[model samples]
Target: MNTIRNLFPEDIEELRHLLQTVYRAIYLYQHDRSARLEASMRAAIQSCMPFLERFKPHIPAYKQRYIELLKQPDRMAPYDLIICFDRAIYELHTRLKSGEIANRLPWSKELRDLLNERQEPAPESTEGDDAADTERVDFLTSGVGASRGEAAGVARVILDSVALAKVQPGDILVTPMTDPSFLEVADRIAGLITDRGGLVCHAAILAREFRLPCIVGCRNATQVIPDGEPIMMDTTAGIVTRIAK
Candidate 1:
């Protein structure tokens, strides 16, 4: 940690990478409840603090904040990355019908390092989204921003490009999460809602890039909200409340 924090220079990607290393095995250990993983991640990060403190050239604010986190102890959880990843892997297994695949575990080079030698970036995230699960309900919500916005509009849930091609002009898109693959139709949409990731997730990034209203991390929102129902989303407030329209 001291080596990564001090010698490596400070940056988001480096911090993200270091975090992946410290807590790489979090998802691999399946416990009774979600809280276990959350707590475990906090512990993992907390365990790195002493190393961070050893940097003699640290600035005042950085040192102060580091000391404060160590003081509180319980405030170390990184929700967006830590807990979300755990839930994401669990969701992935269920969605992929991952049965023995999950048990056997198909990991990438990064994940392998995290699990094997603790030397590389942990797998950023594994798949868990299937917004096209027509077996569920969807709420169309809208807000000022993409990430953390409320659900709204015509819930246009599609599996892939073929289904994406069928989208009507003013529909709200809902996806497990989006990659660069869906950008071609960005202008035709009113908004987006997602179930697999948080405000910092991919859909949020694209929404910002395209100036679109969107929301994410609704957590099985596809299963709870009914299709065609209008919603009031407040991204800043991290809310997606329902309303009649």
Candidate 2:
């Protein structure tokens, strides 16, 4: 009763806002895959809890707060929505970084084992200003300096390796993030976009490798983006704007 009395509705407004956004992302990504989403959400929560216990500097503070608040007797205010969804996102990031999905992705082990076997460099594709400017109309939004230079093309959302044919030399590659498996076409692609990428992820590594325009940490980018639409991609500025032909 005391806690409820103490509460000001505004104190929780941000938390409520965060909850809506985070839940929406989860639903968008998992709506069709209920069993998988439930199991994955459970796994995600478990995976994040221990990271707080281990205490890494890289661990975001809101995550630590979430774990700590969950232990309290009285209700604490909710954190922001980014933190909520980030809990799951970070878990997925950790899993991807750990290489658990590498074996599951067909394009991975071969690249790993064949590092010495393959001598030919990844192919590079660059076009004139007129061509790139023309492709800029289709993308929705981009981040700050995600890729270098400019480009325009069809988008291929590479959430999983099952969609290999979708990646092509001129196609814009979008994914939650990239693992080694998505690299099979990295050299052949024009641009890249990701929802949860940092300097170490395959998206960054291969973007530099192929010199493709790349954007990282565009959360929920895949949700609004449609397939086969023309887009202008600017990786250096981390922007993806639509370019209608």
Candidate 3:
């Protein structure tokens, strides 16, 4: 697809209205409580499914057109650029399907800029952006020591349940909370550290069964420990310290 430079005011406004509708649909689907309401919510979510399947591929083409228009002296109003970009996204969905764009539209920073109001390039990563750069921060927050033992190993910050593939043997698993889904990684981790929970939490109960050093309710363990960095898990004292890496 070609590049986009600018967008028209009406296009932008229309896209914003559509996006608001999508958001409202998602909110309804998530908050639907009763079975009757749940069925309605599911229908609402399904109604918007076509948008997800379409439009993504056409982004590249629409973006190219927008860019070309921007180079012209009589282009659309400057303020309408974001709205136009959003409109293009919706229009593309209306024209194409997911398969059509699946391999066609590779996401890039430039594409993101065109899709949003901002046209600036993404900033480069710095020390502040990377937790690994500040690996020297070693502090301990107390929690319920469900399993008693001390183990030191690299930290694996698994914030999402889908990231179980990142778990490796003897790595310290750090997360906000653990459910039954986390049991898949229980065998590979040397210890478990979580942001919330108690002795009765799944992580605590599993730790005892696995005989792994477990620390629950360590409010900042996941944030303090950089993924892949060395860490000392002192479940005996319910503390996790960032080790110099």
Clash totals for all models, in order?
Answer: 7, 25, 14
Which of the numbered candidates is closest to the native, going by highest lDDT? Answer: 3
Candidate 3 clash total? 14
Residue-level lDDT of model 3, residues 1-245, one tens digit each, is 43222444454455444444533332333234455654543344334334333434445564445434423313443224323333344344333345655335543333333333211122224434434422435754556576779988888999999998988898988899775577688788888889986654446645765678889888887776688988887765566776765
Q: By summed lDDT, which 10 consecutive residues of candidate 3 come out lowest?
A: 115-124
Instruction: Please identify model 2 stretches exceeding 4 Å from their true place.
Output: 1-139
True-vs-predicted CA distance for residue 82, candidate 1, Å: 23
The per-residue C-alpha lDDT of model 2 at residue 224 equals 66
Whole-model lDDT, model 1: 0.48
lDDT of 1 by residue, 22-101 (tens): 44434232212266665765566565555344422332353244344454655434433333333322233232344455
User: For model 3, what is the C-alpha lDDT against the true structure?
Assistant: 0.57
lDDT of the structure predicted as candidate 2: 0.52
Q: Between the candidate structures 1 and 2, which one is better when assessed by lDDT?
A: 2
lDDT (CA) per prediction: 0.48, 0.52, 0.57
Query: Using alpha carbons, what is the TM-score of model 2?
Result: 0.44
Model 3 per-residue lDDT at 208: 65
